[model samples]
Target: MQSRREFLQSCLATPLLLNNFRYSDEKIITVLGEVTTSQLGPALIHEHILVDFIGADKISSNRWEHSQVISKVLPYLTEIKNRGIKTLVECTPAYIGRDVLLLEKISKQSGIHIITNTGYYGASDNKYLPPWAFRETPVQLARRWISESVNGIEGSKIRPGFIKIGVNPGPLSPMHQKLVKAAALTHLETGLTICSHTGPAIPAFEQIELLEKEGVHPGAFVWVHANSSDTNNFIKAAKMGAWISLDGISDDSLLKNAEIIHLLKTENLLNKVLISHDAGWYKPGEENGGEFRGFTTISDKLLPLLKTKGFTNADLDQLMLKNPVQMLSVRVRKT
Candidate 1:
């Protein structure tokens, strides 16, 4: 088995092959040509581009609505750029209104790296509207995602940086199994990292264990929102070799709070952790709270608190910069 260091390095390395395959006679570059994080200049590990519906099937509109551009969201991103923010990861799953064009706008406007996902959401949040539940087998799912990584989503050139999954707070359901099987398949194909959303209770190691069994290398997968759990569980996941996302927040979800930043630094988990407000660019309720529900604390709060706590440039660099880059550099494979 490849060690975490080796795995990350493999994922991060960019290879240039297919010299004969060209766009307009220029050699085409595959996902293996560049690590997602490598293509990303500066990035927040998580963010929402444009989310219309949680359940894709419920929407009476077109499937492509999810793929529509982020042109309307450019102005909201202006503040983030003004605050020196750049790059983002959109965790929206298929059919659930994951808008790439909106992200494109944010990318161009804020000059940020916007990395998106290629897997399913939590069991309760199946926005894919697959017309039926659990349609594809694990092997088949893996093959398709691998095809996307190389050829791009839907045969376009828009590749995803990671494979996202979620262990919702409830017991394992059949739908969950399908997702797990699919994720394992994705791991087999693209070797992209798995970013999981742990539910309200901070799921048990069993879920993580199941993933490892399904072929997801621990080093390549992450359990986002693990900070909601106590220190013991947080450290447990760390020891198990999964990266822990530490954007821990109160109900308010204020950004980079002084207390949380201090807690992270004190525990020495900085190197293995990532930080973000999971900021929502949209107004909650279609313009009231700005689209995102409870993460109000992210926008103007987190970074300033870190600074107030005397987190110097180097400190921020490690938490927000070096750590994620280092982690990505590990499982990264480039052709």
Candidate 2:
């Protein structure tokens, strides 16, 4: 077996072969359009540029000032960029304040690669989901996502970089199963990764089963917020070849994340680990961006702590750089 350091070095030498095949022709979609994997350095996999489920259906009398949002979030984005974060994946799906225009503006001005997603967040009680989504079958939902991935979202030229879906805790809900199926279909079509926001191991495993049933690779699935889950469960998911995203990185979860990383290293599963703050929320029509958090904790704080906990520079680089490129890159089918 190749050591982690040796694997990372080989990948760095010839990145196109990192996926075990050639992906030099592939490009990762961003808010401003497509960019190559080499261009996506030090990414925050799960963060939100704008999220407002409170006023989903109502357009009028809403507090969404474009200029205010831009002005308030620019400084925060700048801080993230200064912290050496080049790519920021905005996980705010449609109907939940997924303002692509706002994200494009932020990306352009901030000069950070901002990648948005395409999918229905069905984790909640069908509130964020549109009426049409509930009535549509899994195939219909998959078609919509396929169109968004191939063409553009909402008639715009900007396309989504990946599929972002969600499910409630415990057993799989009907809608949740459909969402997972749709995500799997989208992955099969577009080769984009599916980032699922799951509460616990049960839903995560169910999603894995559904994706496997759809013939999607286990690596195509990302278990978002895996930090909130139990250690054994996360390790189980990681062993199955899924990307375990510990995205809720913050000052509060510093030591906790360090411990988890230590465990993954011990299990020799560090290659599948991903880390991010899951921070950044720009509420429209809000004063001062509504309790916004900077995206510097991972690079600034958590990394140094992890190093002290015996995680070497190679391990951290694999988590932040190589792992992200592998996850975000579209997986080509073996012919």
Would you list the C-alpha lDDT of every candidate in the order shown?
Answer: 0.57, 0.81
The pairs that clash in candidate 2 are 63-285, 64-285, 65-285
Model 1 C-alpha lDDT per residue in residues 164-226, reported as the tens digit of each score: 776667666667766766776676666677777773433546566677777565666677776
Each prediction's RMSD to truth: 10.4, 5.9
lDDT, candidate 2, 250-289, per-residue tens: 9998999889988998999988998888888876556665
Which has the greatest TM-score? 2
Per-candidate TM-score against the hidden true structure: 0.74, 0.90
What total of clashing residue pairs does each candidate reach? 37, 3
